[model samples]
Target: MPQKTNLNYWIDYWNRTNPASDLMDEESLVSFWDKRSEDFADKIATAGGRKRSRENIALLEASGFCAEGARVLDIGCGAGSLSLPLARAGAEVTSFDISPGMLAQVQRVADREGLSVTTIAGSWWTANIDRLGFREKFDLVISSMTPAIKDAETLERMITCSRASCFYIGSFPGGRDAILSDLLSRIGKIPSPRRPPMGFLFPFMYLYLKGYRPEVTFSRRRWNETLDTKKAAAHAIDIISHDQTVTPAMNRAIQRYYKETAVDGKCIFKNEMFLGMMVWKVRP
Candidate 1:
């Protein structure tokens, strides 16, 4: 369990923030790729495939969300990270996103692989559900590292549309193991208020409120990367300089941390974190 004090505070703060803020908007979401997309795309395209892809697929399978001849809806499916793999596994997939650039990329991948997928270009929050004609038409609805309908109304909308199950991915707030916190603290900046583990909490609370017992699983992945320390430091500098809250002094401090942490011209960076997934059947 996460610290209640910090978790609640963050959740409250996030709730008060604009639900449709740029962070949640499609354009803002894709803008995250502006700096690293080309490099990242090459890395991903060349890495053969991500190891995390298999892990995610396994998690979904264990939860009874198999891809064998089932229909799956991936909201906020950026560049077909999961969608492509699912399609290859023989599932009919519909991926929706807010960025035309991302959708274009997804199309290119699908076309290259000769895989057919329905692509929707729209904001998840404002998408016309009726226009899609997919109400209660999917076996699984998934949102990875993206916000789920936070409030009850949106939750109901998502549930009503999910025929069998829904899966949400959210960060665990205020965990001592948060990688983002470590990165920020190196710059003498206080971490942002921790938000509720909506990915885990939303489905749990939704099931609880509806008189059902949901099965919950907590999981974590440690990503270790070997990067040339000098290059890594430069990249970190670029990232912090662009952040809204980082100051010049803070940036220098972070640079120093990166310098000190480097070993033998390379650094092995590790991200320790927690996440949860919940699943429950909708009563007939």
Candidate 2:
């Protein structure tokens, strides 16, 4: 017989994988992404970005959330990867993010494409959906790889805010580049083997126990990016030390790795990661 896990066990496991960080505090998280807004915008314009966006949109269509004239809310809609395409598809998209910089980029693209996407700046964890008229307002709600979907309460809120369906995508632990993994190990911080996808398992199981049948899809893709040595080094630093200052030794190691990997004026890093998608219809 299969073992049954309790709710507390799943919640605790999920929390362990997603540790709270002062650096990831609401204000700090906003500031961190505000600085990377432009770079992220450029990334989403690349081939890999288009690939992921295409798949996400396809899933939405398959899940019956891509109806025309549908009101969609994209939580943590960074750089409009999903929002822009949906807007162009004729959906009324309301894209929300904690960083104003990200929202600005989304609006900028929306204007250029002649697609109207309403952008809002706020953190889902602390935002009042009722005050913002988001309570049960959207035909489709999406929270893709966002820190906002942290617990059961948040998951319930996401479903409650949508009239029809809610779609979510999140990491599956082993989804980082091997180069970054090596660097982290060299620095004595070995990556955890516990997959981040396990984080999504809790919600899926919890929903099932609540008598809701959630449809799920699993996807794995290798992300490849080539950047100049400087950019590569900066990216490594950001990943290795989220909010902490990179020590001299760590910086030296990162630069050396980038220097060795650079070819034709670019440093390339390729890594495979898993993404889990869950879609639940809120109303029949």
Candidate 3:
């Protein structure tokens, strides 16, 4: 029988074999996110509070990621989508994002909810962790749906910032479903290229290279969301398109889907379930 591959060994091997990724710099990434912040905020805040944002928080809690009076750091915390929930759960959350605009929205929500959260606007790569004024620093470092260390230097930096555990949730290669592919095809646009599996494997490998055996967990969630009006359906389409090119045929197809799938003027759309893996270990 073939030997079962140790997850950490595979991770390290993949990282060493893969070429460097050309991910955008922090400024460019933040700019892209800033431009879409409002749409994301609307979708998340109005998605009935049980979707990706909430699911991420639930997963963290289930994993024992944070505790009462513990300090948590939410990197790339877009508009407090995840930070607010952590704060409400009794952790002292420091929400950091590269975009000031994104941080502004997070602050507004935190202020309105009477939640005490400290917001930092800077690239995690360059942020002075010492200036944050936390005595003992974070027990949990969490980043949801953000780039998980595009380069080796950033990877080391992320590890350096975490006091106990670091959790990174990102899309897996070949994880897209037929539904999303169909939607993309209707618009005559090629699906975004898949990231090399090494993107995920490397982090796990890094831990092994450092002589730690990390605990890894994988999970997925699937569901359909209903948009109750043509406007809502259009908004959904726009969100997916990112205000980029949407051919007329694609628009018609969306309209047809809206008409056919909708009930009582509500449109139903399905998103492919995303699979995420969490790799963690106690501080060495």
Candidate 4:
């Protein structure tokens, strides 16, 4: 029997936690992102949010991979957060996402600005990379802070498709989500007492083993979200259901919590976030 690699360990851990098949199927997943598109667009349009996009591009360029004329692939690009900015910076970008609604947001901007962005809608998990001509076809491939890149297969897909470089950014566990925290405790899902796993570590270590010394960096910020209370409540229930069987009582409790906290039908969730990023040039 072969020994398990770091990638195997990470995949096992991700499967245990995410349960992608059980939680959401293709249609429901698309609907999920479609519903969140409006809210995602609103937040990413904000000053702070826009600044974050600029910062990501700047960091990527700082690693010596210039966006100008680069063939860029942004996986799970929600509302074109990085895709739009990168396109504006002269990259010929392919903005790939699962939601037609979210891709429409990118298409709108591309039409208005005539930026070189091609929006494609499909699940990363279901994408046929070879048939799509994606393997080693990009100068840079990015999978940043997306649940889609949970397993080794997804992580390796980035590597197989990139000729020049790859950048990945993912969240650190144990952030402060005011409403989620309360609802979690109410439903008997208090956060683990043990220390949480470091974000992006497994991916970074995996890349290192494959002979790339990725530049790893950590960032912390506060995200202030303005959510549609009704939609947000339903979404929260969907999230809660993934971890535990959401009983009818638990569902109502989540809804009631959202209603009580919302002001004028909008819920503002303020939370601090810590993220880890790794960038590496593809070795010859």
Q: Candidate 4 — number of clashing residue pairs?
A: 0
Model 3: per-residue lDDT, tens digit, 200-250?
A: 556656566666665566665655656665655465465455434667766
- Cα lDDT computed for each candidate against the true fold: 0.64, 0.78, 0.64, 0.78
For candidate 1, the per-residue lDDT at 171 reads 59
Q: Write the per-residue lDDT of candidate 2 for residues 93-112, one digit (tens) a residue.
A: 99999999999999999999
lDDT of 1 at 204: 56
Clash count of each predicted structure: 1, 3, 1, 0
Ranking by TM-score: 2, 4, 1, 3
Structural similarity to truth (TM-score) of each candidate: 0.72, 0.87, 0.69, 0.84
Using lDDT as the yardstick, the better of models 2 and 3 is 2
Residue 275 Cα positional deviation in candidate 2, in Å, after optimal superposition: 1.1
Between 2 and 4, whose TM-score is larger?
2
Which residue ranges in model 2 land beyond 4 Å of their true spot?
1-5, 12-23, 186-198
Give the TM-score (vs. native) of candidate 3.
0.69
How many pairs of residues in model 1 come into backbone collision?
1
Across 1-284, the per-residue lDDT of candidate 1 in tens digits comes to 34555445554554555353423334444554445444544444644346666767777888777797989888777677778888889889898766666667778888888876888877666666778886898888777765535555555666667888776665565444323355566555444433312455654554564666655667775555666755665556554443355666766676676668778766676656577766656552
RMSD in order of candidates: 5.7, 3.4, 5.5, 4.0
